[model samples]
Target: METEPLLLSTSDGVATVVINRPARKNAVTQAMWVDLAARANILSADPDVRVIVLRGMGDDFSAGADIGEFDTLRGDATSARAYEATNSAAFAALRNCTVPVIAAIRGICFGGGFGLAAACDLRIATADAQFAVPAARLGLAYPQDAMGDIVWAAGPQMARYLTYTAGRIDARAALSAGFLLEIVEAERFDARIGEIARTIAENAPLSVRASRAAIRAALSHDAEEAALAQAAGDATFLSDDYAEGRAAFAARRTPMFKGR
Candidate 1:
């Protein structure tokens, strides 16, 4: 059976979201953005999902939004705003996922594609991957939410440089600028990401969620977010997983987390 442009699959507490439009270099269309948001939101609410890995099919991660649609979808201020809404919604879904979202990027990751990677909690890329934001060159502006993610990932200085210059940076440069967690050789990339995902999945779910929430709260410095993070952390202590964790530690066996 054929898959949609964006595909979601789950196994062993991990959900993998794939950008399936390899022919278009996985450049996302407006409809794909909507699908992405829906799928991500669903995954966020799924108790069985411990982590999410977002990646593109074939050689490239993504070249960014489908510019061919710009004439009809973003031709005017009103239409552009609408188009951006979908894009931001997709990014927000990934950003707000309860579990960590890792971007497994390869080859070209540019423009909105870069924003997508930024929205992820961590990014693992192939050594040959390239990153850029060509909004200026295209005479376009990134959505505010997307811009926030880019700035958060790259820091203000690096974000400014990329946006202003519209130049491409190699994987090493991206890693140095904080946009990537690490770069793996093309041959080992899939295996490395799978290992990382499985490692995360083996941990106590509540603990992972709490850590993510706490970190987000710390970074955002929002009172409400802090409260939410505190609540998540507090919940872990009362969870059955906590008991199992302690028991397994005492028994010197791996703890089997149930996400309770």
Candidate 2:
């Protein structure tokens, strides 16, 4: 029997997290969610990792949850809430990581898979990628945390459209809904994602981190969110990377940032 199949590997300052259940189109099990959260934490704490790429094995990305377990694990509201706790841990770990995350999507992304992609910092998919949320069909109400993630990526309106309709959307429509940043041809997908990830990895880490935090707080009125965003900016101003960036600009040479 196959042991847990989630994979995390880091190389050249970039970390790649792969969902390895291609047989199910990477359908996520609760155990996989726990493993994902742990791996994300490990990646978050690694100073050498400048960027993260999230992907799935085989021809497609994830097809969402392993609904087969619902009868045993999520048969009721309390049980479902318990099941979603793992999802919250995994997605929140990815979202709250200081480093940038890129979701490299190739094929189907449905239900929870769509939620995961939306939580990432950027989503780039192939032209053939498809997305949907089937909450309506299942007669399930999205918990606040999951709904908040959809709202954060798309918006209140698009989130409602997706949840209420339980309809499939193509890559172009997903892009228009703010669910995807770019859609490349299938042949060009790998090269395109590598190019983008390299660009982010080579940039000043502090500035990029600050930009990410501030943008996350852009529409938030919460005091804690405001304070966190302010701290990200303030810390960047005092970072050694700030000094190196300035000197490198003046000297007209590529600045090597050590993420100081």
Candidate 3:
């Protein structure tokens, strides 16, 4: 079956976002980025989806933005800004989702692809996965807001290293550089991702949401960050799922969570 540039599918509380332009290594066009933002909005509003996963349709995750359209779409400052806005919005959407976002990477993930993966809450890669940031070579500037994802994922030093060198790094280097959470063999990658998605899907949504907030708080530097984090954690304690969790533990059975 031929896949669209991007595809969103939800099943059993898990939503998958697929970048499907494998003919060009999943190179995303401006339209695809807009669609990604729209899909992120849809996934966030969907209560049935407790988690979101991003992946590629074929071997390579993505080669980043489709440069073939650059002559027209990014030829001028106005068009360039507008074009980049779609990318920024897509990344922001992924970051803003309260539900955890996981990036399942298999092959080439560079430039914009690397940025998106860095924006995800978690990244799982296959042994063949490779990453790079080619802005330096192309004489382009990486925007400050978008830079946060790379900075947060790999630290300011590594971010600078990757950008300055513009060198491609394999899964082992990416993981060693703290860009990926786990790396599985290519043969077992799909199964491992499925297992992880199922485990997250089976958990209490309330707890998951609360935990996401708490983890995000670690990234905040605002004066009230502590208060906000505490409030979020406190709210979960009063949730119906919390009661169900206690009861289920007492009864020695699985608890059903409704995301309330």
Best by TM-score: 1
Ranking by TM-score: 1, 3, 2
lDDT of 2 by residue, 111-152 (tens): 888878877999999988988889899987765776787898
* Comparing 1 and 2 on lDDT, the stronger one: 1
Ranking by lDDT: 1, 3, 2
Candidate 2 residue 254 C-alpha distance from true site, Å: 0.8
RMSD of 2: 1.5
* TM-score of candidate 1 on Cα atoms, chains taken together: 0.98
**How well is each residue in 127-228 modelled by candidate 1, as lDDT tens digits?**
889999999998989888788899999899999999999999999999999888999998999999999999999999999999999999998899999999
Each candidate's clash count? 0, 0, 0
What are the per-model C-alpha RMSD values against the true structure? 1.3, 1.5, 1.6
Q: How many angstroms is residue 202 displaced in model 2 relative to the true structure, after the best TM-score fit?
A: 1.1
The worst-scoring run of ten residues by lDDT in candidate 1 lies at 1-10
With a 3 Å backbone cut-off (N, CA, C), the pairs that clash in candidate 2 are none
lDDT of each: 0.93, 0.86, 0.88
Candidates 1 and 3 compared: the better one by TM-score is 1
How would you encode candidate 3's per-residue C-alpha lDDT over 91-193 as one tens digit per residue? 8999888789999998999999998898899899999898999989877777667799899998888899899999888899888888899999888998988
